[model samples]
Target chain A: MAGERSSMSEKLRVLVVDDEALVADFIADLVEEAGHEVIGIAATREKALEYLERSAIDLAILDIRLKGRLNGIDLAQATRAREIPHMFITGSGDPSTREAAEATGPLAILQKPFSQERLVSVLSQMAQRDHSLN
Target chain B: MRILFVDDDPDTRALAIRAVTHEFPNATIREAMDLTSLDEVLQERPPEILVTDFDLRWTDGIKIFDRVKAANPLCCTVMFTGTGNEELAVRALKHGFDDYVVKGSKQLRRLAITVRSAYERNNRLRELGESRDLVLKELYHRLHNNLQLVISLLRMTEKTLGHESDRQQIADLGRRIQALSALQEEFYRSEDFRRVNFSSFLERLARNLLETSGGRIELTAELNLVELPVDLAVPLGLIANEILNATLKHASPDDRPGHLSMRLEQIAETLILRISGDGAGSGEDPDTAKTGLGMRLIQRLATQIEGEVSLEHHAAGAAWQVSVPL
Candidate 1:
């Protein structure tokens, strides 16, 4: 059963959203390295929304402080409305912000400069879930 | 110290300035007879002390107080006016005026003394605030630098290694360091540098671990209010992390979902932490046995805080418990 599940796990179509271009590309590289495809990389909430509207995404990795009037939390709300599963990767350790992010029911909130293994673990989990659902 | 006197009456302003100069010979005094002069003096430099009349031609003392406070929140303000009554004095004091003096020949000396006292108190408070800010900044700087240094060292070491398992071990070490960094953040949010709200830390830990489980593990926590000093909290946090990680790792096998529960409560000056998972039995995994680093870490961390650890293996799952005197 383990072997069957591993073989069935598919590459996730991921959206990487961050204000910093370098960090967004780094996350995109990590996603691709983890056997997932980076469908879009967005620097602002509007750009992310545009990607969401234009393509089909399996998952989204978002940074909370985006480069616009709307932020990652607002983007998460949009994803929730669209039934798109997402997780947060944020630099802010503020408690109130954490509370608000958790309210959006993200798959996880990975703090900034997180270990590569952590992101891989979450991506693998999402892939396995997709496999199971299929 | 810099002092600004705002009064429409030139005679009263002159008398108040003389009294303040006598009390604080080194003080720089600026007089404002109207809105124009007040704005000019305020633009030059925000005063450390403000003396204003309650009844001014253009603005009241309270307005002046608001403006000065907006410019410099620590500025000491005194209301000196002839048109002042008991109601007006109460209003002035409520508006953050340090002193309210009625314009009388005898009250000039009293106003000077009150201003001096307020100035000294404000100075002490400002010094204390600056000291606290300095300490917090230094702590933040050291923590950020150290975390970056450790990560770079780990990365450098990982590069020299050829084996996959060795790289995996380095990644595990990086995760542990990240956990410690999270704990440091909790400490920073604390009122005092020495202690943290352990319950919140546990919640964050649980979210970090299980939220990414993709609905494979269900987590239920019964965490009461518990604040532990950094010394105890750090080890206990690491121990809890180890236990939870092991439980969840073994809990879901072959895509089988599992349930993990944690309870942290204080009972009669003792803290009891209980974590259990309804997963595969401990006998199935040799890594969870007594010889593994995870088990050893749990034991050593328990011992560091004079705590006791016990493990129970049942047909359904495994449970680990740790108890320490508060």
Candidate 2:
């Protein structure tokens, strides 16, 4: 049953949002490599919000700092309000930023540039949790 | 050493002069029988040691002590009284009197010894203060140099990552490390070695950030002068850096010139900091805006120092206000 549940979550749709195109693409690749589907890539809060409304995103990787007026943190909060599981991908490892991110109860904060191993492991853990919830 | 004896009674004054003179034969001794003569003697030549009767007919002996101590902080004082008790002894000692001698043959013999020891102790105190200052200065100097080395390493790494997508991230870390180095330099430059003139620090930091950005934005700062402890200054400086980073990143378009302003002042029991920029105010929801790295950092900094943070968005700009307990 656990193996079947894991396989189901492995195909979960994930959304990636970051202002930097290269970083966003890199994160999407990591998500895809982890046996998850990349549903969309959003550069700003508006774009990310629109994707959330139009797509069935099971999980998200958001950047805390984005290019537009609305940042990744805002997107994370929006995802949280909808009870969507998410994590933050940020270059800032500042203690204060970590503290704030922790308050939002994210699955994990993926420090940029993305590490393939860490990203895969974190996604596996999240997928396991998502399956168990079902 | 030169000694001065001030007493109301002629016999006691003469006896004091004889005792001090006999104890140190090479010493110069002056005598004053009343307040009037005490002033004259002090004006002519200030003595290294002042031995006075605590109770005088015209005035209290504290007057003489105050005059001498005010003139030379290092001057040793020995109060001699015919009617002094433990209370008077305690009172005199508390008011900077080095030693006190009650009117007796034995105590008078010890007067000379007391004066000698008093000067010796004062000399030792001055020496200790100077040595402590020297050690602290050297410690901060070494710390500053070591922090600079770390910054250099970070910079070298940043340079090698130019083609990488994460090069900007490395550069950001370098900037924070450089801020730490700047903090160490402030300690090295400060006379006290523990406190910083924060207004000057903020000014230098803002100008450095602007210069690094190639002067794309105009910054105006209205800061009140304040001396802050190292603990408060370090985190506060980082918060300022993060805020400045946000303004530089979001406040203006790349092709247009922008304006940034920062103000820090103390009002009553609280310190207020306002960092604002005349950029397009993103009409984003506050809950989402609060999650920005810069915003979270500002909030975290405020939390560390027991402060409150508020965000404001106007048609012209957006502002962050942090109020901390001073």
Candidate 3:
């Protein structure tokens, strides 16, 4: 219990962004319970950028699917430039999505239907990563 | 030999099936489009090599290659990407991918040569891998025994020292020497080390390092998996060790997990070892240093192959770029 509490005390600030509202919510709840704040929830490229423009999100949990002439990759590339640590969340697990996801260049990929435990672990690990723009 | 030709259009398949079968009457042929059908055909009868389109409707050739490799690592794979990236074609060859041929062109005759060449290369590698697998354990043992002798000699050469710092330096040197010996082990364990999978070698090294480091952090290496001549591989390995050691030393608990990018690009007749990373704790560029042990060692290794090394501030992080003759 003490270990868990200490883990939560870090209280990382993360953004839960995906096209699927349910997935975004599910992740939002998980990261929050892990003791991190879900600073924003975004379902579209525009929404992600809007949230970025509005809030200082420490991490971005981006879905490969997004609205309007853009995709999770675009958001990922955008976030990369901003020095925001991010990972792709996907349901398809299909080749096309996997190829596109790989090209976008995230730190690591968490396949769809990943366990809450796995999701939290990835978020925690990435959240603690140094973000100084170099 | 049997060859599996995959295409959705029956006519294309018919034409290809004819083209090769007619040339080699003993050759057998089969075709597939989707993964399901491919699996079925493969189960019924397996082919020695596979010729597939890079952009199939339901499944692409890369997927086919993956499935084929899983099914039989010995099976040769050729990609007919029509007109995919020449760069991808070049890289695909680095990871045991036999060959890449552009599709539907005046290069039909060229395709014939390619098919023959890939078949020989693939079969040669397969034969080597198979024969060596039988002797892998014996090879590993012999190489280890030999290295132990070298290590003993190295220890004797170092001056006797009991200081804590001196002992620590010896330990560090011992570990690096053991890593250097892995190249010899790789030569024996693998079919040959002259043309080896640098990426796989690095992965094994990373796993070893991570285990020593208590396995707390996850280290991922994105290697393009290029193979260089033995003359190049020796120096390339040492240079890589230096950069890798630097990254591991500098990567901190608070810092993001360090990512290392190593690319060996063949520019003109020169093969370049461009190793760089986002992490740095300690490393000196010996080029300017009068006598930097680390820098001089790396410089000497590069020059052994008539290669040149330079430090550049790349977009991702700092880069150590080495270019050498092929």
Candidate 4:
């Protein structure tokens, strides 16, 4: 699967947005491990949108609850307007949170402590879906 | 209490009327000599108690008992039988007749006692049944909610866990939990928690997998209408989830579109499940395809249901077939 992925025209350019620095870096590492390039890791909505404006990111992984006034769901809604496909990584399973996240039609929702296998699997699948879209 | 007495023989009819009147002085009794009169009397006023001779002129007492029970489930019925009709009386009792009284000069005296006791027993049984249903419904509700809670906690843990190996284990555990949660949700949707409609259950399970697959695959199902006991449905659902995850993981090639298909049918006494997907199996050893935690789990689940799992590679894709006792 990795070999086939490497043969693609380009590695997926992924942006990671989360309030937690450690978690942000963790997702970046996983994205890189999955053969995707992490353009930037944003700990706030402002920084995340800044990265989106600066870089051509193919995908985004947003944390539902962020530190700032605008959370990951807000970022997701913004991404929808940008026509950027994204997924969610969240620590909470509140229905309201899930509902808001789902309203974005995310590629996938990665719960905390998600295994490397799941991350790679989902990212690659999302990459394929994104590729077909392009 | 209003009682309907049906007996073709006038002498036996008179006997029953005397016994019932003696038992309850305030009771209003109606008499029917044949099936026509029985139907008319039933239409006029359905009885709280129906005491009738097993051998009627037009139809047997069993038919009358069935009619009354069908029209009004709360109606208590007693089938009066002669000496040689004892076996028939037992059969009627097994078929939901409240009780049966043997017809004889002396034994006929017990008819009124049987009628009164049976009616009381029927009322108590009805109350008990309603209460049991309420309790079962409450228990199912709590069980469903608790299962959702566990899945939520697992999902949260999956997001936070650091080690890749540990996260994989948690992810696997989470999938199993989700499978159980799906079953509970199905139970909530169903009126009978003891049996699951296999076709609908699998349809929902397949759609759920498709939802998480990121639209990279097209899923099609050919399912037979089969109802399975709750015990079998849970493990079978888990097995389906495991195999689905495996297909989503391995079968999807980076370049081409992926297709996953599932078919379930009952052949003879065995239930057969076939799940196949376009993946890496072409030109690869079928034996190697079977070497995975998913395959092992499938095997274990098959054994749990007294079945076997087979992994095969065809020209188009890889497939797993599971055959279990129905």
Which is the better candidate, 3 or 4, if ranked by TM-score? 4
Lowest summed lDDT across 10 adjacent residues in model 4 chain B is found at B280-289
Error of model 4, residue B79, in angstroms: 1.6
User: Which is superior by DockQ, 1 or 3?
Assistant: 1
Docking class of 1: incorrect
Fnat for each predicted structure, in order: 0.07, 0.00, 0.00, 0.00
List runs of model 3 lying over 4 Å from the truth: A1-134, B1-140, B148-160, B210-220, B253-259, B280-282, B285-290, B312-318
Q: Find the candidate with the highest DockQ and give its number.
A: 1
Question: DockQ of all candidates, in order?
Answer: 0.09, 0.01, 0.01, 0.03
Tell me the spans in candidate 2 whose CA falls farther than 4 Å from its real position. A1-134, B8-10, B21-47, B55-63, B82-91, B164-167, B181-200, B213-220, B224-231, B249-257, B279-296
lDDT of 3 by residue, B207-245 (tens): 554443334445645566566555656667777776555
Q: Tell me which of candidates 2 and 4 scores higher on TM-score.
A: 4
Compare the candidates by lDDT and give the number of the best one. 1
TM-score versus the correct structure, for each prediction: 0.58, 0.57, 0.38, 0.61
lDDT, model 3, position B139: 53
Instruction: Score residue B321 of candidate 2 by CA lDDT.
Output: 80
Write out the backbone clash pairs for model 3.
A130-B256
Over the stretch A16-90, how does candidate 2's per-residue lDDT look in tens digits? 887766556666766776688898998888999998777777788887766523267677787887777788866
DockQ of 3: 0.01
Kindly list the per-residue Cα lDDT of model 3 for residues A1-134, writing each as its tens digit: 10111143456667777665655666677787777887788877887888766776667788775642338888888877777767876543335557888887776666444334456666666655532211
Residue-by-residue lDDT tens digits, candidate 4, B1-326: 88888888889888888987888789888988776777787788788899887776688887888888776778999888774476786798888888888888886669889988898898999899989976765565345434535654665686798898788777778677766666765665576878888778778767666655557778888998878889899889888888777776666666456788889999999999888898654222556546767667778888888878777767777788888887
